[model samples]
Target chain A: MYQTISENQRHEFIAKLQPVLPEIQYYLPSFLDRRILFVMNKMGFADWQNFMSYLDNDHSYDAIFSFLMVPVTEFFRDSLVWHTLFHTIVPKLIKNDPCHVWFPDCSSGHEVYSLCMLLDILNVRNRVRIYAGCKSQQTIDKIQTGVYSAQCESMLVANYKNAEIPYDISKYYTINYNSLICNPELLSNVSFIHSSSLLEDEVPQISLIMYRNSLLYYTTDSQHTFITTMYKKMNFGAYLLLGIKEGGNIFGLQALFSTYNKDLGLYRKK
Target chain B: MEIATTYKLIVIGGSAGSFASVNHILQELPARFPIPIVICMHRLKHVNSGFKETLEIVSKNKVVEPFHNDLLEPGHIYIVPANYHMMIQSDMRVLFSTEELVNFTRPSIDVLFYSVAQSFGKNAIGIILSGAHKDGVDGLHDMYKIGATTVVQDPQEAQVPTMPQAVLDVMKPHYIFTLRSMIAFLKAHI
Candidate 1:
């Protein structure tokens, strides 16, 4: 006998599964099949057994999905973006003192490191205040520890070279068994907020908001809502850095921000 | 540690079928190969997601995406990230530019090859692999003029023959080999 999952049943499954599998829920629309497959493989069960077990245990689909959606990042993955920001953007932010920079959905903290590197290179680490928010506390802890893999170190070295920033990157980390633990001094001026992107009630007025490459998975309506929230949070003339392929005409919100084609597609609030 | 007086740097340029070629070459090289290998592959804009991870998995040596102002280090593979032109400095530092695209590619093969040739001169090795357009032709010629070792993938074996054939049409390289043979040649040289 073959059992079919109805749309309502899927929605019910998702609603039941969200709390335990937050990542999977976030990635559901885009990653349903992959998440299902991952859970099956993890449980060491065939398809039928896995489905029966999930059904019997009343397993939260969200928990299962969260386990599947990997949020891996490396330090300074894209160096040009950091270079443009340091050389062009941060200097402007420094000129406008009492600046606020918001990183919504900062996942782990590579984006944070990228920002810190910029502030350090520009010699204005003191001028700007950073507010980074993410949904996962585990990610926050990882960010707090500031430990990264050797792969991250290699990437960081490359980014430093590309930006022409002179800093001994090796000096920032102590090697321990193929892992590089970042110095604690780097996190002194930054503030970490453990909050969900969906639940944040009040966003402080910010001069620069960097939401890189994470909005691709959201539904069209959700993306509009998120961008609208960002528009509300940003002060006039605030700069927003988005993933290259992300900003498009969703909910006719294109006119709200003056789109600049620096590094493909970075937008500045008008 | 015996420091070699002269360091040989290899810059590989390719487009359409470059990824497979790179994997094939890197897989054949030993982990301790003591030379810097820089690659400039025309990548789609804003899609700088999996190049490094994929390359690192395939290659024996450490593979990473090049960052702005990074110093060139030996025993590593550096890939030019998407949407930026990668240039090498005489002091062996990396230079990144968002200057207008060359031959419609931001990470243009010609840009990297020309700068590397200028920086390393005779110590530089320039390789032109499979590509649809003739982006790296002039850069390979510049390498030839500067007495640098130039190699082009045998057109018959290349996925796209135009790029390698274009270089062969202008100046003869020191060696021409299929991808497999090219790996052997590079391994022997390094």
Candidate 2:
């Protein structure tokens, strides 16, 4: 449904895009290129010039942000990571006090919802406060509606099974009109944050931040900035969950935080 | 036979019966193979760790499952992790995406091959090994047309010839190498 920018033309696009979308300046060029092409093609933009002209003329990008960011990707993507989080990390995070969880890049909310089901199963749903970060209200509304294609049901069930969920996943959602409607109670302990970015947001006292598959897109400088920012905001005993690929000390921020589980990308704030 | 063209990255795409051939190629390579070899093979997504571990045991070079923005380094064999589409950047960094599936697979060889062709152009080497799908054909075509060196495993010897046959049907690759000849070619070039 969309056209992609050629690799030859990437440098030019990055040059044009940085001044406008400063936040994405540090994103890995390949990933940003895909997202840019997706937005331009989906928005009927003939080329980068046309896309830029529209952005210049419109002076608004709420729609662009909606189109650019991906939503509701793999649920419990790496089941081992999810298993580690529930079994190992969460217990330490919620040692005594109620835990405040953050999802700084909560695109479309499937991951957060997966956590909601997990938290509910743990019966500590009442003790955790989840902050689902959103760039626009469209995402909030979409997540609140909690409707997904029935086609994806098999994968969800499969991931749930792989994660070794004790309860049947079917109880959490009902299929209607070829859509899976998540139970409304899933959002009981969740709070939506419009502040958008963890880098800029001073939202404090987070016990855990589920920032998986996200840091890989960031440039080294931005990754350092993020680690530094989280170091300040996260409580000393809090935890951070990155993507599984972020294993083996790739982030190299050990001075600030200790590696709780290197393979699963779970860390503890020192 | 010596390959005349200088290359920066070598990306190998395989599936089904290519595992043994891939193992052969990696096992034969010396410790300091300068060009980074990126292997994108279709494996069971739920079955992740074992494949990497098995490859590690056989290969001389260090096998790595790369994250997004992992800088391409010499002497390391980058194996595309299961369940994610892996791509290469012009800056020699590996990238990952969970966006969607292509050709009924997540770590689609086409995605990685096409991305490398676009980013590395003629400097990259594209190799198609034995498999049962047509995933790498279009991607190999892209790399071939872009002036990158394209090699297809000998279809006659391929355990599952569908993938190699599919590539042969589209465009004749620069070199059609058997398992031994491919290792020799790689060792000679490096």
Candidate 3:
């Protein structure tokens, strides 16, 4: 029989894991003993002996929690989201020349690319400056590389189709066998930052902020906290896009933004 | 006949805290590391896609949303698309299912781990990261059953202990380490 963690032990575990709260809240309910046992076996703990030995040694749970927060992104993900941005949002923002847009979890510059592509299609490339952020230096380097693979090309093609943006997709990439490197010019007007959400102090005022699908991992409380902070940073009438499932109700902070979009559920400050 | 030389495959599954965890592991890994990584993250049923780019930027690994029948390759990270369950085939091809969501997740970790264990056997490495539910517990056990190496992020280090701790309670992983050490282990082994 699998040994179950006592409520006390579970409490201790939760206390240890608190640094990653809110994001972990979504997964806390279903972690019964059987499930823990199953995870132990899957990780090759091999019965009780190995498990006890691991517990006895020095272990850093924060490192493990970091291992769990794998935020993977692609260029121009969710064609509809980009479509809405290009057709509806960008047009409104472009009226204000030299508009600044912020992407908090820019990750590898795909969202940057999406934004650039939108600006290019709208013929507003010279009228915008983008501030994109990622927590990893390595990703910042990749964003500097301005290269991508053919696998990325497929999605870019789809995004182009959905947004009805006109450009030869092949022209933006230089093919090397199966891989496709994005043209350097596509990234000329972007700025990259290596920062974490917890550490950011101040942000430039901007007309639009796209934080797509990045905040769902946080706990609802943290989500509210971050949203509150973001609300402070955003300009009046600034637009914010959260993950589809995220950002419907701001609890007591209902005056910040009004929710819109049936398929995408985007929020904009009133 | 001797098998052709190829990179070992590592598949990691998790829900919460996955972004930070994957980034930590990938950051510790050198650019020359010779292994492919497949990730299955729990996402909303109708969510907008951007996760692949997010992971790619954070990890600096080549990340893509896995397409139906896409050939699995080394040096690239494939993410199971949202609203679909991703699985691996005997020949290392990617597969997807639009079947009803299990545990309310389309890109389930268990489904991916089980398929990879079946396909690669001992060559496969299965990891269960931080999450709220028991989604990957069964699949990690399946990996152990198939003689593949299995790992869970030490619950002490997990953003959500329920997911990794749940595995620790049931599964006896060969190794349990923080994301840094896990990346070091994978780098050395790969």
Candidate 4:
């Protein structure tokens, strides 16, 4: 059997990487304990020492950060969330004007497309603008391409069916060489940003922010900062959608948002 | 008698024909056991409504369907919630992913076992109970390689032998305890 890294080695690896990529400082300590070596091997380095040696300049930071990004997302994930958006939230927002929506931590564009699919169904496609953000530039570029490998088609279709969408899932996309290219028209007003929402201080005021399923990756302090910053940057009466697990009232932010749907983790700003 | 004093986490995975064994394990496990136990089973996403309730009825410890980013605390049996792959992030928080199904199962046995191996290393213990396929075998091997304690039900005694037999075929586990023997061993050790 192979030997795993000792506690001392794990600490040493974190100590070495923290200076070059300070963003990892906000990750859960246990996350580093499990993933530090997995990430090292992922970057084509044999061990911690080799990874440290490769960190020769400022340019190495991007490569290191890319290795940490988990691009594991599916289209129309959590069918209920999409159902709620299409049925309840989107209708409320679009009643005022064309709503500007933001999907921070867009995670390879699944959420953006899911929302676009809903907008298209509601005949509000021309009325909405989506700003999709992620920490990985490569993911942003991939999102811009609007083509997903067909491996996810079954799951996407299943989710759509679960959400009880009126049209067949195939109506939305054309299949090419095992890739599902989203209809170009759906992506017209979508902008992809290679940025972290936690770090972006000046994003456009949004009416709906879909920040689902990514908060646990950050430390508690970062989570707090993200909550308040998002609250400040959103328009009055804006809605915030978080991971279902994150629905509990955040400390000190109860006065700002009223719970819209606790099960679906939707909050509306006062 | 000192088994409970060792590992920080214990992960158990099962699939078809597993409920009986899981119930037995939970009933035998101590409420005050000082390690967190995470149980992952392959169940249809939409039909898992009663799973936590079922486990809590037998479990002496608190049985929880944990939220994303929920901290791992001792004296609780954490059940893998529906429609997500439960991963132990390097930050020690329990994270759920809507990632593609592995081994045709979300809350994949391989995913959970490998994560516990990575997070706890020698401080982890993984046990594979009755299951239909080979989902947990690779993960058990990963745990074994990391010096974590690995165990499998005696395939001969399992309701479905394919899963445990797969583990036995790969890495030699620390113990291959049947339901009765496993309970006896824990009583003796814990």
Could you say which candidate leads in lDDT? 2
Q: Once superposed on the true structure, which residue ranges of model 1 sit more than 4 Å away at CA? A: A1-13, A19-28, A35-72, A198-201, A249-253, A262-264, B1-190
Cα lDDT tens digits for candidate 2, B35-132: 89999999887655487788899888899988666788999999998877888888887777776578989899999988988898889889999999
User: lDDT of candidate 3?
Assistant: 0.67
DockQ in order:
0.02, 0.39, 0.02, 0.32
- What TM-score, computed on C-alpha atoms, does each candidate reach? 0.55, 0.89, 0.51, 0.82
Of all native A–B interface contacts, model 3 reproduces a fraction of 0.00
- Expressed as tens digits, the lDDT of each residue in B1-190 for candidate 1 is 1222254788999988877888888888889678889988877643445877888887888886654446678889988877567778777766654444578777788878877776788888889999898999988888888878888999998998989999888889877989888888777667
How high is the lDDT of residue A170 in model 3?
Answer: 63
Q: Which 10 residues in a row give candidate 3 chain A its minimum summed lDDT?
A: A26-35
Task: Give the i-RMS of model 3 in Å.
Answer: 13.6
Each model's lDDT comes to 0.71, 0.81, 0.67, 0.77
Model 2 docking grade: acceptable
Q: What clash count goes with each model?
A: 20, 0, 62, 10
The iRMS of the candidates, in order, is: 18.0, 3.9, 13.6, 4.1
Q: Specify the poorest-scoring 10-residue window by lDDT in model 2 chain B.
A: B45-54
lDDT of 2 at B106: 81
Residues A1-270 of candidate 1: C-alpha lDDT, one tens digit per residue? 111344554566566556554433544242344344455566665755456557558543334433443443556656676767877888888788688888876766777877776686567878788888766566677788988786667666766677666666666677788887877677777788865453373557889888765554554466667778888888888888875434443333476788765343478787
